[model samples]
Target: MSAVPAMPAVRVAEGPVRIALVGSPNSGKTTLFNALTGSSARVGNYAGVTVERREGVLTGSHGGVRILDLPGTYALDGETPDEHVVHEVLHGAVPGEPIPDALLVVADATTLRRSLALVHEALALGRPALVVLTMIDEVKARHGRLDPLALSRHLGVQVVGVVGHRGVGLDVLRGFLDDARNWRVARVPTGIADAGARFAWVDRVVHEIGADVLAADTRSDKIDRLLLHPVAGVVVFAAVMVLLFQSIFAWAVPAMDAIDTLFALAADGVRATLPESWLVGLLADGVIAGVGSVVIFLPQILILFTFLHLLQDVGYMARAAFVVDRVMGRVGLQGRSFVPLLSCFACAVPGIMATRTIASPRERLATILVAPFMTCSARLPVYTLLIAAFVPATSVGPVGLQGLVMLGLYVLGATVALTAAKILNSTLLRGRVSVFYMELPPYRWPTMRMLVRQVGQSARAFLRRAGTIILAASVVLWVLLHVPQAAPIAGATPAETARANLEASVAGRLGHAIEPVIAPLGFDWKVGVGLVASLAAREVIVSTLAQIYAVSEGESFRGVLEAIQADIDPRTGRPVFTLPVALALMVFFVFALQCTSTIAVMARETGGWRWPAFAFTSMLLLAWLGSFITYRLARFLA
Candidate 1:
């Protein structure tokens, strides 16, 4: 027999009773949220140990409740925007936001004194606070004792032990949710509210509890013994990164190839069925070809996210930041900058936003300004198309030679970004280096659910950007390259060959006029056309090139590659994209801030266009200079 569902619970003036999970960095607050809400939360340490907020709804055995995973903060008495939000929400200060009815103070059992600082601070507000002792399993195995009941009594709130990842304490926490009266505000003396005084009181509470709390196992120390070794750690880190790149290519290649093949077949079907005409060509080449070209890269992107998701889920990502901290510090960045900087390897927008955790505005802005120098996954389509066509995969010892080149490009982008950040720090956005401090979460096996969710979220984000920006850009590029139809010459190919007539169109004429400016850069009129086309979106460079070379036909990668390889400059009779030019092109992409979305986001986040404008102009200058040097040097070397 079906059981009747519980009736709705009492609603506050704010609509629903809102509970926020608050804690110190790496206190497993998000993990608890995932457990309570059955949410597939994407957990990662943001900008070292500073926390970022996330929210989910929990409606299970307990009545429905909205759960906010507030950023893990050390204390709530700050003017920092994140901390301020927490304070305002608790005091009903933020307009249009719900005032939290209950505060679930997640505390790490292994480090009770440090964890309790926030709880003690929260209690001062006289709000209903419940202490959720997190990581009880780790605490018991390593620390040797924890008296949750005693700790609760001392703090004047109900405390529950939770092994969040393993799904413990949900029932206990939920039970307390039904009876708000059990919680009370503790009034502590102002003298005892000093940092040292508060810590002293917390220490006394643990001491009085005797030896029931188990200590946290020194697993981190043991693991760090090898993973943190200077030479070995760097070696292992490099090996891990190489494997990630390989996995991205190997695991996703088949699906990407299948996507390409399906689209190619679809184009063929359209060509065979419809009579040769401009409308048929636009439908097949302009619409189908343009969208499919971008979509084909999604599988590889999803694959990359899967590996990143696992690393983050298993808690090695924090260590990765620690290991890279020294290198990052040279550029006025913290160890926490590692995840976001590394994330920029996938896309700059997320990487830029990820810098929010950096407390220092100058450091964060510098990080943001230089972030686009890191090659994003969007560049992959361009790189793969070019590299496979141009760079040979000769045997390099035991590794795939092409893979090493791909790895070099990635490393090159990072190196450039780091150097750029250092330059920006010293010249434009100088600031004091932020000291690195972050808690390493206990290592755990990644759940499939977590990996799938993270990967899906990343892929969805990538596709969404492509759909909005790239999609619109592609349509505009297609029209620019195709419309304002060039009047057919008396004896030129028929008007049906619209592509041949494109050279006389508005876009083509503009490309011709600007051709001389970039000619020394080894760009011909068609390549200039591509550069213009790319202003809409970078990947469109591939499709534009495809159209330029296959104008008589449509979009074909092989056809474009062959044309590029064979084409001679009309003025110099030299190859248009010589090795020098290709290298220069790669260098330009490394430094250029090409995405409009990144600029808009930077403007909004910084609350003005000044930063974005500065970023754009500075990056464009760097890109031009870098590309020029690369071209001239490569030519001189040859």
Candidate 2:
């Protein structure tokens, strides 16, 4: 072991010091950031590469400190977008952002050697820096003990140990931050020709601080034996996913029913209080039915988010990526693409954003283009509505048939995405495939505080969308379906009058115009209207259907679904929304690129209209074809 070096005395910068929190992914840097600043910035066990940079004020007995949580990067080299963002931020190249006054390089204590290479890169920048060793408990559990003071001496910099999640050693860490004047640049080896030199230097530091913890068979390793086995890993992964989607149905039933009952009560209240006029129609049929239809899915979204957060916190997500690497590689996508694609189940906008972590532009573009094919939370309402209406809630062995259908839809989307990626890699975006590399962090017990925060953030985002875009779309759709009210016939009932009014509305006319194009897929003019309205968001499809039927049938959501089930086609004198038609609608939604937010994100990510336009056109065509085939096949089977 080498002798520890003495730290040179230095003066801390005056005024508020801007410190950039840099670390490798999953190093607990964000956890430390949250602890120091008391911000609820999202934390994930997997590499959260797409999360935007966040800033917060760290206030303590030492006054206020400005802390910028930079994106996690394995190196300062600009190889990936995350690294580039961190690099630019550190260099003050990003406009309106100052160069950091100092660097807080956080390292995973258990994986100290892997983290030190980046720490070395930071030191080369000639900035006053301090090392914060996080996950000290994990290190100790692995029979490792780190003396931060000794390590600081050996590295010629200040060092502190913190268990960010448990809030241990945080006050001491803060006290070190307060004494920023004593912080000094680390004396790392210069002229590192290759990674070998970096590892050698890291080994020396580890030995000097007595942080070379003895290896032992632990719980994670024991679990990984089964979870990482080729056959068992894949089976467990599939089973986990099936249960996740199944829980979306099983767990959310009570919450969904409650939301539905509440909305029904609100509608009944409005009907009783308001006069029989357009105002009443708007409030009962338009606003309540439209918004409530989409809002009811909030429970399922939250549940899905909860499962995702739990899996991430427990460090299963990275293993999932590893398990699927071979399968993904066959489709020209690296294992890293799995995380972003998995994120697509929540929404594609963020998934597309997450492609930034992919090092190769061709691979990233390919991933972005196909990300929307994964069934997002926005599609949940439509899927749930159709499956409930058409698919029987019976058991396929232990699994509910409806749940299987939902899982099938998700699987179908992923399959299509992978197929599309394969095609793109062979043709338009063809390039050499990049090798996937990821570190599997040790699993830890998920904390209640972190889980609640994650669930709350997702719930807030979902509600915000419901309040803004969904609300606005519902109102606009209401006006479209209600205006140009027909002159009343003397003997006509209120329902008849409402139906006539909808038939004469502008929305009806547009729907009629598009009906011919969609007829092959078993959709009528009304369904056509919904497909059009939902271009703003996929969830709007359910709301639009509710609004359309509410005006025409003057019914509740269940009533509307029942009415559709019994609807007679005027020409054929047969039921509309038959099993075939319902299945076709699901297929269409599964393939359609209808969400404007997703399109906008794709456009921004691809840096042009060309690719997004191509995506929209291709997806639209695929949706039409898929729906046509599904309708024909289902009709034949029926």
Candidate 3:
């Protein structure tokens, strides 16, 4: 190792000194970023990728310091989009962003040898650099010894050890940051040619500053014995997921009912105070019904996120990924693809963005193309509504029939995604399979603060979408259903008049035009209109249905469900929403790429129209086929 000349001091004139936190995936970088800046950036146990760059202001005795949490990457050589972003940001190539004044390279103490390559790369950047060793407690628990002072002396840089989740050694770490002048820029040996040479140098440093003969972590190993046991591990994972989905239904019912009651009361108050007019109808049916229908699912979304964060915090996500790697590998994806696929349950937009962490371009593209099949939260409202209306709520042994049906839908999505990945990898996106490597962090109790923060962030995002996109779609649908009204029939109720107007309006004509195409799948013209409207967002289907039905019956969510159950077909004189039709609708939602936001994100991520267009066409075809088969089978059985 050679020592480079010390660079001249650079000082900020007034504002906070900008610092960048960079590290490999699963190296505790996010935890340290959260600890230092009080930011609630998402953290996961698996090799999760952050798509967006987050910035926070850290305050201390030295005053406010700006901290930017860059996406985690294994190298600075720009192999992945995340790596490219970090490379650009550090070089001041990112538009509208200045070069960071200093760099903090976070490394996992348990895997320091593998982590050192990136640390070496960061040091080569010639910026004021410091190394923060996170998860030191895990190292000690495994009887590993690390002397930070010795490492600092050997490397010619400041070194600090901290347990980020527990907030240990943070004060000492803060003290080092408060005095920025003492920070050193690392000198790299000029002749080092390749990764092998880099690893050789890292080996020498580790031998000199880190202890040999570190004991194994028996506790983690023992837990892994069961959690990673091929059959047992998979069983446990299945059980955990089943419980999670079951709770989403069972636990959210009260909160959802409360929201429904509140909205119903508000609508009643409006109708009572105002005379029958277009304004009253618009407010009660368009705004209240549309927005409230989507908002009622908020409880389920929050509950789902809470469970996800808890699993991530407790460190089981990595083990779960490991257990599924073999199955994923057979489909040309590594274990890293699991997290992003799982994220699709929340929304495909983020799920597609999470592919940046995947190193293999082919694998990443395959993951993105199939992610929409993962049954996102937006589809939950439709699923719940159909399940409640048709599926019996009887308990099948230990589980509710409705919960089992919900779980089956999720499993069906996963099955299709894996199959699609296999087909794509074998044909359009075929490439060499990449090896999977992951570190399992020790399990710890999740902090309430962290859990609360994550839940709050997810809830706010869901509400914001409902407020903007869904609200707009609702108003548009309302106008489409109300315009070009025919003269009112004498001796008819307001509900009858509204129905008559809807049948004569533009929306009705469009729906009827498409009804012939979807008739084979057991959907009516009204449901066809919803299918068209849901392109903006999957949850918009719920709001669209609510608006259309509310204008006629002026009913609450439960009442609407009952009304749909009793709806008679004009030709067959049977209930419109039979068991077969409801089941077919659920199957259609399970496979459809109905969310336009997802399509837009896919376009942006893939950097063109081709992939997104392919995704939309393929998924839409599959949805129609799947719904047709399901409807046929269900109708035969019924």
Candidate 4:
């Protein structure tokens, strides 16, 4: 860890004023950040829907200022990881990070009591914090008014009204931050009071502030009634999800094709230019083909995130959580689990990180255990290719029948996870009362900068994963599938002969020996060989299978798919991947915890190998059993 500078460091030249906005959950803190920062930060449903942070540079008279949007929480008692990060930021305890020169605490005007809990906690930390009462429009519309002067006098902090979404009251907030010395800690009552004392202070402040203003309907409440209606809300939710999945297919197809064409052109160019040797073969056939196969899916990945970003910007994520809370709870999950589970829809790493919002250890653990079951973007390419090949595209009513199958696979993963969670909650992870508090934040338009940052981050993360573990594994698989000659006897060309000799190699023999056990599961020795190689990454199975089935016929997308479809056992004269085999493969993929990145994340998040060990063992076991049963059922039915 690096050390924090002795003082706040800024560029010598004048830049934007570095201001940090802090607030309790649903206090409109982010709205204020969006307002002040001009919505420059990307908005998205974070790993946990409960808390999300955004940052942007704000232009000011003095210079450019850096602004941070923090997760909303009631207090800094450090009840959860998100709260704990807040505690650290205020005290300058985060490694190598400077404390903010000014703190802006957004408070909900209507819920003065609930919001003040965070204000008092921030004040106690002796930081340069001010109170910005948000949702004033909502308050006034609801017949609530606050006396800024009295509230400031009582709280000993500067108070300002900020309608963050509309850019209202920001100049006053900025003018206050221009001078940090004016900020001071709130003075406590002369003597300590009972547990209710804090509540009493909250009530007194509201009364002095003239809490009630008008009885008219607030804009937010009116909007909520429509968006949160039980029936209308769920219909809208399903529509949005359907739209997102459809967009991934329809919007991304052209871009994906373009990428594929470009890579194919590059591979052909390289092969033409370079001498026909192992090094060129490695680049053209092994590295380029294997990695490019995955990288081309970036278009689909980007499209998936774009929809997620839009949903978050519009603030319907919280409502989705509320709508799904009943279903989640029935599966022994907290309402808070909705965000993390939804996050797992993208990737399990962030989902595990999002578990920071769950206060109970048991709930967090259960969430982590089931996170990997969520269909992540990594699995999408394999699923897409297989489904496209096997499942015919047709309409089921108004819906694309292929898309419904895709949706079914996602639902399958989620259902298995929820079931697994229930079983675990009753056994290994049972205990403790789970709290389900969260704020349904108001919607805002997503800024361009925020969208770019989020998409960039997601893309970079995927590339990094592919570069490190996947690259190393691919090279090793290349060698295992390529090296060691069986015998150099007859008139076979080197190209034909080299790989055939691999059967005498260590990897091939092992795969051959294991073939009998997996034969019933519809896997050949070559498939067994790919599986062993794919202990490194499940997606690699496709590329490895492509290579294994290619033989001396040469490789192409159509050729590989045809070979896969055409594969048959010499003894049975039956296709290797029968419909049952394909169905079983799908089920196995649905339940298997195959990503090494997810495993490493679990270890880091849980602070040990114990949790990851448990996760790996149980998920793999379940995957095996589920696939075996699926294979048998398919065969019996056939």
Per-model TM against the reference: 0.83, 0.81, 0.81, 0.77
Question: TM-score: which candidate is best?
Answer: 1
TM-score of 1: 0.83
lDDT of 2 by residue, 1-638 (tens): 25745332223354677788989878899878877887434332112233366777786634447788988888887565567778888888877777888899999887887888888888878788998989888777778788888887877888888899999989987877766545787787678877788889888888877878757637889999999988899899899877875787688889988998999799989999887877887888677866786678777767777887788789897888788778888998887687678767767765675576565556788899999899987788788888888898899899999999998998999999999999999998765434446777777789999889767766775576567666676677778877787788798766666667767787778889999999999999989888877776787666566555653433545766676777788899888888889899999999999886677667666766788899999999999999999999998998
Candidates' C-alpha lDDT: 0.71, 0.79, 0.78, 0.70
Give the true-structure RMSD of model 4.
Answer: 6.1
Tens-place lDDT digits, model 3, residues 183-220: 89876565677899999988888898855446887887
RMSD of each: 6.2, 6.8, 5.9, 6.1
Model 4 TM-score relative to the real fold: 0.77
Q: What is the lDDT of candidate 3?
A: 0.78
Model 1 RMSD to the real structure?
Answer: 6.2
lDDT score, residue 467, model 3? 84
Runs off by more than 4 Å, candidate 3: 1-15, 40-50, 60-64, 178-182, 273-277, 336-365, 374-414, 431-435, 519-527, 533-587, 595-614, 625-638
Which tens-of-lDDT digit does each residue in 519-544 have in candidate 1? 67666688777777766556767766
lDDT sort, best first: 2, 3, 1, 4
